[model samples]
Target: MKNSEPIIKVDHLFYRYEKENVLEDISIEVPKGAFLGIVGPNGSGKSTLLKHLLGLLKIQQGKIQLFGTEIRSFKDWDRIGFVSQKANSFNTGFPATVYEVVLSGLTRKIGLFRFGSREDRKKVDHILESVGMLDFKNRNIGELSGGQQQRVFIARALVSEPDLLILDEPTVGVDAQNVNQFYDMLENLNKELHITLVLVTHDIGVISDKVTHVACLNKNLHFHGSTFEFNALKERDLSSIYGHDVQVITHHH
Candidate 1:
């Protein structure tokens, strides 16, 4: 009952691969418990605007909607939860265990030829005890580390209880003290399971203060909003959204 709409509602977002223009005129909305935080730099388009908001790229000229439909009739793909960035390069000696890789994220909600019940192994043991990895479930997902296999692929993208998760660089190879305890377990799963985060990072000072919104792409949309108005901008507008010389340092724990 916490959805006050706008769980992502881009507009005018243009993408192009055949002739450059990765993402120009991109607009964003987010709302519904947003955590946002999508900085930029390396080739700008921030994973091509998160693969055009997870439809894996198609909307070539504009409008996206997601939780309010219209991402080409967004069929509620298990209410969205994607982890990507090679989601821990599997085939780890082909053995699989951390509770069969977080119960294989419920194979797209329990239907990969149907199996999971015991209430889907108690919802993959309560999402591997909310990503502490439930005491390493049964270990051996190639032995853990790399922040415990990225908290077992974020408990396999939160065992399908997704209400918009979408991570990309998720502390890419973790460890600067586990990337500050993996963004403090993604701010305790966005303030204790309210979800709706959209992180894509180049570590803008480790999500500045655990994000509350702050987009600043490069190919376009050079800044969005809040996180106290993107920390009152201008370190030369974050060094012109990372074309060079960015020196923002505001971490006061």
Candidate 2:
């Protein structure tokens, strides 16, 4: 039962910084419940296009609608949860506990004059449990390793219970072992929690294996389809997009 409705739609999207153009004539569509991955080289407008989806950058040439509604300030802003790569790049010495940081996402629906209600705290607990970070909840964020901190941020993102979750290089600072675990975690979120994931990353080796669909962007959008279609692309084509001799090992289910 494929639905024609889209969770995100971008038509003829473009963004310019003063005199320089970052994205040109870009168009993309993310259908409901799809795990979509964006891959491209550095300075190839990957993050810029992601900002458009988040509404961090305004549309200079086109329209973007999220969840069937136009990109408006009040309605669409809080509905999406963003976990950026910079979150890991942060100095861990920031004096907050992991529990405190994850609990912050509850601010979305929390009312005035109250930090977080009892129900909010309970919801935070549930999200932490889902992300398998319950025991680390009381630990200081700085004391934990990079992988643990990423899990905390993921818990924070899910605390809001968003229908759409956008991750910008979620595996940027982690080790290979943890990176696999991160993708596995996201795969669990997609299957068990059923959250629609849109991720911007340069690591095609990792995302190419996990995502349901791939969107290759290079100042202009190029390809959009199932990962199977991407797997069908020639090695030369893959190397061209990645700018390297890339190889992938996939398992048939």
Candidate 3:
């Protein structure tokens, strides 16, 4: 691959679900080590787009490349880590400790029946420390708060040392007060850990302050640029993207 190749590239993408065109002529690029925040109103095809990136949905009328390889030919799935909204749906009653939960992330890599080696255990501990959940390693997964559980899940994803991390509405069940801290952790992952991040979230104001780039979508890709450029858009421009008047309140850190 060329040195300048983007980690993810979507070109002239189009998708339809039965009668509705869910995405139209969409295109975007995510460079390695960059933090990209995707913001859009509900039913704006954001999830559909993410599915394509994850290679879950077949590409119908567009091209998508991951790590410079076409999605159809990309086989290094382990290089990508995904944290979904379903994390909040995790069975809180499930009998598992935080360490076990994070270690499970390596099941695919280490074989389903094989136990983790000492090296693997150390890796898990390091990942937990990076995510600030090392102290809770012995705690029951069911005992943690939504925010803490999310951090554990992130550590689980990190255990495999993925180069790209994708999150879909990750803060769904987190308390309002802890949302900022959650985003702060994500920022550290992107900045300090140098993991490429593709985040789909509704927290536009908060995300705008953390992400290096922003993409505003509404079936079509309305905006894809630097955070500064996205923040400079007029309210009317943002309203047109959302199909209604909207306000973006930026929070300073």
Give the top-scoring candidate (TM-score): 3
Worst 10 residues of 3 by lDDT: 244-253
lDDT for model 2, on a 0 to 1 scale? 0.81
RMSD of each: 15.1, 2.6, 1.2
Mind giving the per-residue lDDT tens digits that candidate 3 earns over 99-199? 99999999997877566999999999999998889999999999999999999989988899999999999998999888888899999999899999999
Model 1 global lDDT (CA atoms, 0 to 1): 0.81
**Clash totals, every prediction:** 0, 0, 0
In model 1, state the lDDT of residue 201.
84
The pairs that clash in candidate 2 are none
User: Residue 166 of model 3: what lDDT?
Assistant: 98
Candidate 1's C-alpha runs over 4 A off are 1-9, 12-37, 40-69, 76-80, 83-97, 107-137, 140-146, 158-165, 168-175, 180-198, 205-235, 239-253
TM-score for each candidate, following the candidate numbering: 0.34, 0.90, 0.97
Q: Taking the tens digit of each residue's C-alpha lDDT, what string does model 1 give over 89-123?
A: 65657587888777888886676655588998888
Give the Å shift of residue 249 in candidate 1.
9.0
- What candidate 3 gets wrong by more than 4 Å, as runs, is none
Put down candidate 2 lDDT per residue, 17-60, tens digits, no spaces. 89988898988888888999998888889988888787777678
Q: Which ranges of candidate 2 are over 4 A from the true structure? A: 1-3, 72-74, 111-115, 249-253
* lDDT, candidates in the order shown: 0.81, 0.81, 0.92
Error of 1 at 64 (Å): 1.8
